[model samples]
Target chain A: MPFIKVRDDLCKGCKLCITFCPKQVIRMSDRLNPKGYYVAELFDKEGCTGCGICARMCPDVAISVYREDKKEVPA
Target chain B: MKVVYERPESLLDVPFTYCPGCTHGIIHRMVADTLDDLGIRERTIGVSPVGCSVFAYEFFNCDMVAAAHGRAPAVATGIKRVHPDKIVFTYQGDGDLAAIGTAEIIHAAARGENITVIFANNVIYGMTGGQMAPTTLIGQKTDTTPYGRSVEANGHPIRVCELLSSLDGVAYLERVSTHDPKHVLKAQKAIKKAFQYQVDGKGFTLIELLSTCPSNWGMNPLDSLKWLEESMLPYYKPGVYKDIG
Candidate 1:
């Protein structure tokens, strides 16, 4: 599974990620956090490619991207 | 398989928009490569200025802000103040820094803003159609200086690193160029040192990059690089003006 995390407090709400993501998995969350800036959220993880576009586009260094890889064991 | 020199992991795979043979691309690559090497990409916030590199906000692949005109230093100050723990730097061009934003840079250094400034001094206003800039050589001609810059009228080019090193607030200052591969590597080292100073909680740091504007200079890319080596480097030699470390 691939997941994206946004440090809500650090987000400046530049909206650059929305424009750069190829999967369009990211969108401005409807709810405004305490900072009054719209936080970025992943609308669908199934479409995420773990390309790390959202993390790259963030101007505040507020996001982190992670992907889980499973190693198969010989039966 | 042969090894390839790939783009830095800190930089996106997107192609740059700079003109062919423009040194901004080289400097940008150096900065990105340095960030990747230092493992600071995740904590970096780059402030892009208004000049040929104005769209640097797109190229860095890190958190970046667009500063008005030459006010990158001012914007960077705010970002650094709010997030003192985060690494902050500014990418600026000659017209953006030395011409319109000179006062801002000077004050930022004087105040010891604890940020890195990557100043690309191409000696002409590139984005605005190649106007004579503060760093333009004494006899260099541009759109604004049709008959070449007269020393009596335009004055001599400002030695920014030399001037900034004289200040007590600045912890590091270096002038470098990207007209050649060897010098490109040297400039990269200087840029890395500037960022390292800020990360170490040292005061202000600035790296003046002597870049080439081939399209604006009306010369082919190779010729422009040659001119930069034979003419520009002679006037603006590369060196570390100040390094506390």
Candidate 2:
């Protein structure tokens, strides 16, 4: 399943990523990070298409999306 | 697993000082990515204005200069002239470009200076509190215009792209928004094109991004994005105002 990974320490919990996700896969966690804002977490990995909306919309660059079917662009 | 997206390397590691959901952060990343993609990060010098974008120097991972209140165009012109080989751009807000720096921008485009301008038009001034800017739509209420802006009393919103499009010296002019993901992608392309024009020796490229000021708009992030689509889009129609390229 495609998934979303958020760096808890870097998240400001702005919810922008959650707001822009068309798949509605992300939710604000009740738990607060060191920054004291609620961090976002993926609600369901199975629903993700890895369109990269959440990852690109993230202001803090805290989220990264991975899709198993796709190949990495070699650096 | 394939990594779909990550932070652009041209952006610094410092956390953004932008307010939650502010589109400035998104615009910043796009410019940084464009510079990195074009291998111009080392040669780019970004000038930031005095509004909300004042702290932009801290965000972009390039050599940054802070211009006086609404003088980024003048500053950028000087930089580009002195270091002709360096890529020069300016990050400016609506208030900075449309209001106070109107002369600077007009003359810069008039003279066909080889520089890129990333305009973030959020309608209200973000840094010094929310006051109605020159681009604020009619009937829009702000800190200064408590009831609403009356066209008769305040005049109409200045569409910067449309105004500058008439100038013969402008090489490329576009207006895009950050209202949604698809539009964000388009905005990135517009920003990239604006920068690419300068690299190709095209003159005075400007990409005006219709951004959202949620805190001042008194709306949540989601609602602000919706407002940008419903309200701001009608007044400032998104399109290529001019493309001499």
Question: For residues B140-240, could you state the per-residue lDDT of candidate 1 as single tens digits?
Answer: 88999999999988888988988888788899998987765467668878988888888899999999988788778998656777788888888888888
Count clashing residue pairs per candidate. 1, 0
Per-residue alpha-carbon lDDT of model 2 for B120-207, expressed as tens digits?
Answer: 9999988888999999999999999999999988999999999999999999999998988899899999988888889999888999
Point out where model 1 deviates above 4 Å. A1-75, B2-4
Candidate 2 chain B least-lDDT 10 residues: B1-10
How accurate is chain B of model 2, given as a TM-score from 0 to 1? 0.98
- Residue range A21-72, candidate 2, lDDT tens digits: 8888889989898767788999888778787888777767777777766643
Comparing to the true complex, what docking class would candidate 2 get? medium
Question: How displaced is residue A12 in candidate 1, in Å?
Answer: 35
Off by over 4 Å in 2: A68-75
Residues A1-75 of candidate 1: C-alpha lDDT, one tens digit per residue: 566777666554545556567778888787676757677788898776666545543434455666654222111
